[model samples]
Target: MHKRLFIPGPVEVREDILKKMSTPMIGHRSKDASKLQKSISGKMKKLMYTDNEILLSTSSGSGLMEGAIRSCTVKRAAVFSIGAFGDRWYKMAVCNGVQADKISSEPGQPTLPEMVDKTLATGKYDLITITHNETATGVMNPVEEIAEVMKKYPDVVYCLDAVSSLGGTKIEVDKLGVDICITSSQKCLGLPPGLSICSISQKALDAAKKVEFRGLYFDLLELYEYIKKKDYQYPSTPSLSHMFALDYQLDRIFEEGLENRFERHRKMAEYVRQWAKERFALFADERYASNTVTAVKNTRNIDVSELNKKLGEVGYVISNGYGQLKDITFRIAHMADTTLDEIKGLIESIDKIIM
Candidate 1:
């Protein structure tokens, strides 16, 4: 049986969106390809609410996250972590030999604005990365509040990992002063995995120009220059397949309305949280709970693997708690095209099995 995905990413793609991906291949350098790329970028601007230069990479969001940190950090980077994804960002920095310091919050907590302020006050860091939403713990950082703290350090390039939040929520990239806001195709975009996208401010591009050894494939400056010079074309062969689907998906998103899409996600999230609270216990801080996924504390110590097995038989599947939280908690995703009715049905199914 094909189980429905209620996990964080690779969400249930609508049949129409999947069909768009089956579109025949086009020459990456052809005018038709440029037009498709141009159209997607324009629509992405409306979705991201930014006028910054948009870049697409044929990799997951991590590719851009790594590129942003490696190419733009002139002095050092302050990475704030609330969960595994944030930790992964820090790891990317360290492995790349970038000078970075990790400032982490407890598992279920958030990276507070004060934490950002304190880190930036040291004057030793010129770049910062914040995970806007961490899937592991289901905690959404308050980017708006953190943006206020970032204003105090204007020279620092601010990066956001919106991998799991961007399309599902309202992230005003320009208003937030995010130098580089990264997101992937799979998460909230309701598309298959393969493409990574970002809105890059000129400040970040300028910083990238000064940095050396920013490996070619994911180089921010290189990618930006290629897109500008080639007219919306990528430096290497692009994922035209994903781009076609993304373009179509963006149309669907806007047709439904961005606000309506976000509201749908919020309603699904709230329903999941309430269900978790009534049965198990909510793992993340309620105030900062994610609007895409819910991390429920396994107060009753249920065998999550067994639960998933049972749910799979019924054509439903959620996620076990990520990383260290496995078995200790469980996660139910409500992002992408998932509807409130679908969420209610999943919870009702769980109730039948658990109760």
Candidate 2:
């Protein structure tokens, strides 16, 4: 039996969205391709609530995260870690020889606004990267409050990794003062893996000019310039299939009303959190819990592998804990096209086996 995915990414793509991916192949440089690209980008701006230029890459979210950090960051970067994705940002900075310092909060704690203010007030960094949602710890950093602190530093470039939260939550990129906000298609966009998107503020592009080696392929400046000069087409043989699905997906998302879609995610997350509280405990802070996924502490130390096996037999599969949390804790994602009824059914099935 094929199991339904309630794990993080590549979540269930509806049949219509899958069919869109099968759209006939088109020449990358043709007018049809440009039109499709333009439509996708335009709708993406609505989704992200940004007027800044959005760039689509033919790689997972990590590619754009690396590209943004490597391309920009002239002086230094303040990398904040709430979980795995945040740590990866610091690694990306160090691997590329960028000046960056890694800061971390306890596994379930939120990175406070004052912390960002204190770090950036020293004028020690010109760029900062934050993960809006961390799957491992299931912590949703207080980006809204953090953005308030960022207002004090007008010159600093703010970047956010919203790979899992972008489609499920409403993140106002422009109002948030984010220079580079990144997300991928597979996570909340309800599409298969292959493409990623990021909004590039003018400041980030200008900063890239100062860096001598921005690297090709994923270079921010080069990609931005190419797309601008050539209309919507990139300097790449872009993944046209992902584009077709994304364009159609965005229409469905908008038709559902952005507010309604976000509300649905919040409702599903709330249901999961309340249910988990009755049995297991949430790993992340209640105040900072994620709307896309919930990480539950292993209160019983039950065999996660065995439990998941049983779940598979029931036509459902949720994620085991990530990295170090493996077998110690497990995760249940509620993003993309997943609905409350589906969530209820998954929980009901798990209860039947466990309870």
Candidate 3:
């Protein structure tokens, strides 16, 4: 069954974008490749709302996330968790031997601004990792409010995991004071999985220069030097396939207009939230809800597995709870190319099943 993905990520790719991925293989070092790479960076800069240099990785968003922390955390990091993804950032820091501590908000809660302030004011940390939108809990952290606190700590590097929210929201990367805003090709970007992109500020690049083991392949300063000298190309052979698709898809996103695209995502998300509240409940704070997916509490305690089986039969699929919330909550993505009508249709069908 060609079950439509209402689950997060690898969300139904547009056929045209898929076709672009099949484009004839170009030598990674060829002029064509450089042109494509350079062009895509410009487009991505516009999309991310940043003037900083953008780096492309052939790995998932987590890859760049780990790279950001490992490469830039020269002193120490304060990693904050609002959900599973944020916690994973702290894990990434520890595994990389980066000195760090973890702070967290209750599940279904936003990581409060005061918490970030208290932690940063200690002067023991020089880098911070935050997950902007957590698919696991359907919470969007208050990035703007956090940015206000960041202004006080000039030396601290601000890194964000925007793996799932980049294209669906107005992240304002530079404005948000994000030194490295990491995101993936899948998720809100509406492209297939493979490439992870990051907007790297000069601050992060300088920080990477001081770190002893910034690691090859993902070394931020190395990537920057390569592009500066070689005219916008990766130090390693890049994935031309994902780049072609992303390059094309970013145009489609702009065609939708950035604000308009963000609005569509917000509208779809609100629609789902309202629907979920009428029947069950939204898992996170209403004020901090995600604009890409909604995690609805399992108030009815119905057979979620059975519900999925029935949905699969009808060519539709959504996500059950993530991690500890499994079965206690369910998630439905409203990101990428997912439309209002599609959202309405899915909700109507699910309503028939549950109501």
Candidate 4:
């Protein structure tokens, strides 16, 4: 039996969206390809609420996260962590030899704006990264409040890892003054993995021009220049299959309406939160809980692996808490195309098993 994914990412793709991936091949440099790429970019601009240049990469959201940090950080970077993905960004910066410092909140806590304000006040960093929705601990950082703090440090390039939040949540990229907002196909976009998209402000592009050794494969400057020079084509052969599916999926998302889509996710999240409150305790602060996923504290000390096995046999699968939180907490993802009915059913199924 195919288990329905209630875990984060590679979320249940609708059949119509899956079939769109079967589109026939197209020459990477052809005008037809340009038309398709342009169409997707135009739609993505609307979805992200940004007029910034849209750049597509044939890698996970991490590719662009790495690209943005490496390309724009001429001086140093301050990477804030609320969970695993935030740590991953710090790791990427270290491994790439990019000058960076990692500061973190206690697990299950959000990265506060006051923390950012204090860090930027030091005037040692020129770039900053904030994870918008961290899947591991199910915490969503307050970007709106953080954006207000960032306005004070306009010269610092603001990068956000919206990998698990972008399409499912409301993030006004331009209004947030985010120089680079990164998201992937598999999460809220409801498309298969392999392609990542980002909205890059010209301010970030200008910063990249002054930096050296930005690397080729994930170079933001090179990617953007190619799109501008070659009419929306990537520097290398792109993932045409994923692009085809994404184009179709974006149309469906719009048809459903952005406000409606966000509201659907909100409803599903609220239902899960209420259920968790009635049964298990929530791991994240109620004020900062993620709309895409909820991490529940394992107060009952249930055997999560055993629970997953039982759920798997019944054609449903959620996620164990990520990293050290495994068994201490478990996560239920409610993003992408997952509906309120499906969420209710999953919770009821779990209730029966626990009962």
Number of the predicted model whose lDDT against the real structure is largest: 4
Worst 10 residues of 1 by lDDT: 231-240
lDDT of each: 0.93, 0.93, 0.91, 0.94
Give the clashing residue pairs of candidate 4, or none: none
- Which parts of model 3 have CA positions greater than 4 angstroms off? none
The worst-scoring run of ten residues by lDDT in candidate 3 lies at 230-239
Model 2 earns a TM-score of 0.99
Please write out the lDDT profile of model 1 over residues 97-142, one tens digit for every residue.
9999999999999999999999899899999999999999999999
How close to the true structure is residue 129 of candidate 4, measured as C-alpha lDDT? Answer: 97
TM-score of each: 0.99, 0.99, 0.98, 0.99
- Off by more than 4 A, model 2: none
Clashing pairs in 1: none
Model 4, span 5-122: residue lDDT tens: 9999879888998898899999999998999899999999999999998999999999999999999999999999998999999999999999999999999999999999999999
Report the CA-based lDDT of candidate 4 relative to the real structure: 0.94
